[model samples]
Target: MKGKLLIFLIILILTTVPAIGADISGNVISESGKLAGLIVDLSKINGTESDENSITGVTYDFIPVASTVTGYEGEFVFENLDNGEYRVNVTYEGVTSGENIRLQDDTFVEFNLSGTIDGYVFKYNSTIDGVPVYLYDFYGIPAGNTTSGNNGTYSFGNIAAGKNYFVSAVYAEVSYTNNVTAPASSDFIVYDTTDKSDNIGVTIDHIVLSKDANSILVYEYIQFINNGDRVFFSPERTWLAIPTPRDISNFQTDVMECCLEREEDTAWIDPMIPLMPGETYSTEISYRFNPTSEPVFFNRITMYNTDYISILSEKINGLGLESTFSESNIVNVNDKEFEVLDFMNIPAGMTPDVKITGFVPSKNTGSDLGILLPLLLLLSAGALSYPFVRKKMLLKKKKVFTVKYNPDNPSGENGVPSGGNSEITALGINAENHTSGKTVEEMSFHELLAERNNLFESIMGLENEFNSGNVSEQEYMAQKKERRDSAVLVIKQLKDTATNLDLTQPVPELEEVIRHIDDIDILEKLFEREEKGMDRNEVKELIEDRIEDIERSE
Candidate 1:
């Protein structure tokens, strides 16, 4: 009976206990820096409801749990409450920061309201005020708009923290957009100045030009320096715009120096290579254009804050070609001379013209004195030997010229074959003619570039012929292989010459061929074949024979 009574008392005591409760307290601060007198609302999230039309594709239902106002210190708190989910909301001047949270036990939370967004709008070197600045959410919905101040600065004090925004503005009839991230406090978020023609820090360092029979090629090296503390790049749109001449063809961009992406005429340098403060980026770009016999005028567009501009042409220096420039101050680059145009520091509100007049070198002149010295000596010798040559010609005409020696007929003469003299003479003439032509190493810069271009064209033509069924598979592969081999040799020679001359460029087609010219043994054989002056077909046959021998030996 006593044990039963004790069990009953234990059950009665358990029934008289109270349920556990929790509390949530936190401080609410304004991100706009207006700390005091801000409304802080705490509400219990009753349940979640899925609504496709909601801002975030979902909506929440809540009931008012507690409300308070921030003091001068921007602080607030809530007393004991049941352990459950709660929503925190802060509103000041129609701007709000609200989010849901779960309250368990004595939870402490710090609520950060909206933050301030301020930045400057720039067009090149000049700052433009009175321009309307618009802000958009990540969904592209319009958030707020304001006009820039007298100093070209605009601010939005109540921007939600931890959110991305698209900032846009219109100036000089062009619309510009930038992607920006709001910081996590009331601190000022300064967006980088929009890249303008004046604000582009990239300056043309030097330009190397080559004038050939059909086209003019340019190798341009440019440098980009970031002066501001912030990195220069645009996430939403292109920040750097590299302009090209009108009707430019065969344009190529090499980012091995400074990685960038090229889109036809414009090369986007920034984004791929963010120009950080106190850092500089350098890149080399190349392109070619065909000009008529008439003089062709070319202009390189310049941005603000230019340091120096230079143009060098071997043909111009060699042939003493007649060329003109807007500015004339000759300069030396890489130990090579160049006609330079000085802009030291382009003044603000001034767009100086960077025009260059170029033309094909005249055939009457030689590229160097070495070529002219031989011609002059020959002329002088010819003038002095005119009488002796006339007498010799008369004697030869009077003498009976008969085929006394024949190299082909060994039995026709006494010991010496008949026509042996004529055969010797023919061989001498052939040797002299062969020596007059330019070798691969002796070719001019223009000729070397032209040969490379021709090889590229030949490779493409071979591909076309095979694709159109104009050639058999065997013939196509044979010709393609031979042409590709020749291209490899030419490309290597060009690259070596360019390196010695400090002429850097991007040749993707040649790079591809070099990549596939795999075997070191094959490369050595090709070099030997080139030394022997073998034709493409002959070299191809040699390579085939080598491959077959290797296979058989294996």
Candidate 2:
């Protein structure tokens, strides 16, 4: 019984669910921004259109048309229908237009359309210029043509469709007069050009243009090439910038600078200049200016051609662009001496490019003198001077040429030695260095004592020189440390190996060891195979190892 009750309740709830539908609405308006009363007819194919008055707020609800639903006021819809293709035609009165579709099940569909028409009307005769011929519709869409200047050309753009329209024309009217008011009523003559025609060609609408008795037609224009002519100037792009006069009251024409603006970083590149077909660079001086009394000056500008002022909106600030004015430059790579002439600033309105040739160098003519008097100077100095100058240059080069020579001992072919070998060899040992004359290792105490004293005196001398600061810190430290180390070591060795305390020892002659260690030739050969730049640590290690090798040999 519980299972049967649950089944019955589920079926009842399913059947009782409410149905959902789509809502759509819209309005029909004219180009002139006015209310438009329209008739909206919704229909499926093979069915008659059911019409409704769309005059009130141009809105409507979705209503069923056959099995599908359609909007009532340019607004249409589908409520709860299965997916299928359906076409709709929008119409005001009998004039029907484009279509929309309902493509899926449970989908909402809405759409609208109107015909847009525009064209030009050329009158065969060319008597008057600047006349306006226009069309007005009760639906508020306005369009039509105007008179061509003496050439008999006129055009109308941005037209709209759907409704009755009346055409009229007015002669001697101002250009682009969209307001169709009193002048149009009196001077314009209306014509019945079209009634239901959706697409039509240009139609002639006649009108009159009246001038006040005291007024005369003022004509304004100046014609020239891309660059300015002699009479006008390229106007300044701005009124003023920094390093410029604030009031243009003292001058006549606008000043101008031409440049290309870049979007990123807000930067601009002047001389975004292009070379012309004649290999001449052309610039335009377009400025909007009133009539001025004083002649426009192109003193600040450089390019030569200046004519009557031409007006254009876009501009940049005081950037002077360089062109191929001449193939000469007084300023060299590092010349900073330059001055602005008093006549550089342009007046309030003038703009032009004046070409300047023959740059003048303000400095005395030493460079010219160099070229002209070269023979005389050479004769006086002669070839012998080359050697002296060369030697001086070489001396200068020696400072940086350090890898090739240690300045502390430029005379040496080798570096300093540890001197252990001198002490050992002098004791008459046959330590296999058979070249030297000494022969025995077992020396008498007197001989070793005399040698130890010699080494001590030499070390003392080196230490004294180090304290006096006569030598550089590097040289003094190296020499004093080497001597002190060798002296102490040899002194102990001589004491132990000696046979008598009373006997004198010979001086430890370290000249040969020092000479061998300072050998630059051997060093140059080693450095040839080594990397070009030896860092401090590497140099230190190399010297230390060489010293150890000489000491061990002793």
Candidate 3:
């Protein structure tokens, strides 16, 4: 009778209690119908808050409750979810969509995914058929390719929505490209092959020469100008033929590999895209060669009429040109000086000879007699005095020493073994010395602001130098990275210090700093800092606007 009564009581309790929670369901659908195996995130709305000064205005605080993947029918569910405000987010092919709702009982949500690209290829004004069309993502990754249909139409489906893409078509051996967004149409108008022109000439030929240990490195920046009324196209695709040394090594060009070809002593610039009339295009080439004689002679034929030519050589101890072609001038580049030789109005097919004199090999000190003689003498003297030095030390009385610790003078001023506060530490640095005069932890907020400002100025100056062609690409990139990294560290320190001081008001120093920051990465860091460090909504908005401006410019 007791067991039966207990069973009856348990059944009564189970029937009286309500269900655990409600159910949240959703589905993802695209043009293809339904997307299966898509991950859906369900987050409960913990709360909502507003920041009047923030660019985002009001923001929602979410607590992730559960996650599920869509089934074969692109449907997902969160069972036993308590009645409350919730959010459902689904991501497909790099595109994300979300929806929020207040769950009273069972709820359903739907997501529509759109990603389709379609376009047509045209020659002049008429649609062209059988032209090969290619699609590439914003990152230059080839997404798909197909030939245009009889109607000259092309279509790509199921690509990521809200993403940038590139559409290109090749016609008559020339490639035409255009940028497009998903769910949009892009049309390409290509021009047919034209006759080659003799009006193509070189506007500027700037050569920069620097020397390595035994080889001379050369960088050539050539600008080609088409003076014809029609596009300059050659049957062989040879736009310009540049003369190069026979023994040149590590030859490289800025153009595509297909646009450049080399034969014995000549590098051909065969650009696939024809040069438009009254337009100029710049090309860069670099190579290195070893000198075989005291005065090296560089003889090269000009393929086109050269308007102006300038050669700049690095200032080395034994490196100079034999004669100045025109008015020679010394120019400073990247804190180093270069000797410039200028010439103007050289006709085509003229072979200009440049003689480089004073080719002195760098001296090696490993076989120097002076260094070896002194080293041998010092060794001999140390060996001859070893016995006498040992005997005298043995006769001398030993002195014992002890270190005394003094709280008043802890740096060994009071006969204590110095803790090496002024000496090199294990990390190969002086404990009490720093290049910035104070350690990062010891720097004041104002000092950090000043440092950041200086770094910004340095970056700006570096960009100017790079733009002026005074700095090499490799060097400019390396220095820019290092300076930007330092600036980021300083900015982080400023953020932490500001937060600790509870800086809620606008600061002129910080505002000035933000106004000067052009780097997108640094601006982002400052944006994050504004959330917790200083409550400057205007500054945040300023940064946002600047970032947008930069993006547009790019």
Candidate 4:
């Protein structure tokens, strides 16, 4: 009876335990025939969940189970997988194909190979070797990357057929992009580099002065134009120096503190990027100082050959202003009247000066004569020294302005508070940080791209404000750096996520639907399909082209 019971227990244990012999088999083939020597990967689908908030809308967890190389007949298999869902992937060169299966029993899968792409990089009519080339799918996702060969030629294999892709080549820190279909050729044209500053000139030099209580705020806009054909590439980091008054205070510019080096009476600014030909680059500088007495003189020395230098100062009721420039007029800006001074064709190292005088106390105080009798008598007795006494009193009562950086509130015109307080909210240094309240790692590829474009527009708008002399240099530089840094972070994340995407999975047949559609509304719906597996460059391009053609035909 004991032997029989032990034998029965052993039989029950064997029956209850599940078998782990379910196999998954696959073959890699092309239109020609089955191909061999391909890397195949098998993964188990551990779980899956829906993510409505995600651009992909679905999340999958894959556990790598096994890997093998295809045999002579392009056959591969995983023999010991459990009875569960599995995926088979095969990659040859840069192309990938994959399929999923429910492995209740043995399963068989097949993969079709794709096409290839080749390109070249040229600079100054000559091919350049060792340039880095990047490949991006239609959805602006990075697919692969390689460097140019010794002959300046580059190629990528296994690209999906009948699909459009973008190829970007980076040479001398500049990137050139071209769109092409698979099984096609593309080339890049880049310019040679130069560090010569002879061709650089100031197209517009504008100065704006506004009265903030007793202090005078000065803003300078300098737009540099490159007239040369070659890009201005400075290995040692080029600098443009602007000479300011020696007594100026609160000096600031649209660059980091390290880049905007101040010494005695000169503010040196480093425009970060390489100045391309026919492009206009701008820099802004601002400072504040108290006028000590009548005929206060403001001086600035030009660093480049300036085409036009215009100085605009807000008109004070009792104060008179004069400029060394003979061309003067009165203009209205933003509902405020200003005294304008124009200096044209100023040579480098030439100085422009402005003088302010007639500093008389306002007589419209509405105070009774009895209250002002003592003050009038004292001012008459010291008429020659009245200006000095008034300046001294103004300095004594002047409030020290404290600049506070706030990422949320960036709408101030010139970062000056209207209230009679010492604190002012300046441009945010990390405005992008608070924009979406999401870190770069947490953002999806679509979100990252959108953020990148927004940051770019913000930077451009900041530069425009600086050029218009509407914003202080401190604010422009702070916000520009923050936005640029955020954009860089987002771009890096986008590249990483794009390169890691499962390109082996089948893309939806979006091209067919897009080709048959000619309405703008249909094109928009095509973009909405990005959440589905239909997101591809071919679909986007076809939709855009069709819409344009339809609009033209209409």
Among all candidates shown, the one with the greatest TM-score: 4
Q: Predicted candidate 4: what Cα RMSD to the true structure?
A: 20.7
Relative to the unseen true structure, what is the Cα RMSD of model 1?
28.2
- Error in Å for residue 127 of model 3: 4.7
lDDT of 2 at 460: 43
Q: How many residue pairs clash in each candidate?
A: 8, 63, 0, 1
lDDT of each: 0.49, 0.28, 0.62, 0.61
Q: Which residue window of length 10 is worst by lDDT in model 3?
A: 425-434
lDDT of 4 at 269: 75
* Model 3 per-residue lDDT tens digits across residues 254-298: 678888889868888876556766767666677765556556876
Tens-digit lDDT track of model 4 for 1-554: 99999999999999999876877887777756778988888888775554432222235578998889999998888887678777676767665545557678878876656567897887778888888998766544456889988888998887666666768887777666676777788987677777767677887766666544455556666778887778776657777667777755666675778677888788877776667778777766777645565567777666666666666655753344675343345543333455666555555555656676544223232222121222222222222121111111210121111334445654234332222212322221112222567888988655565566556545654665677788899987887888788778977786665544433222222332343343476465555554354334444555577677566545
Choose 1 or 2, whichever is better by lDDT.
1
All-Cα superposition RMSD per candidate:
28.2, 43.4, 26.1, 20.7
lDDT (10s digit) by residue, model 1, range 1-554: 99999999999999998765776666665544547777888889776443333222224567998888887777777776887778777765654555456667777766555666677876546666788877655433356778777877887766566666656675533335565667521112233434442344644445555544545665565666676645465444445555555645555564433546556445665444345455566655666644443555555444334544444454343322222223343322223344433333322222334433555624332222122222222222222112111111210111111234434675443322244223222100110001115666886544565565555545554565567688899998897787688668777776655434311111221232332332446545554543232122323343455445444434
lDDT of 2 by residue, 126-180 (tens): 2334555555432122333345445433433222243333344443221122322
Each candidate structure's TM-score, on Cα atoms with residue i matched to residue i, is: 0.29, 0.17, 0.39, 0.46
lDDT of candidate 3? Answer: 0.62
Which stretches of candidate 2 lie above 4 Å from their native place? 1-4, 15-37, 45-82, 93-95, 105-115, 120-554
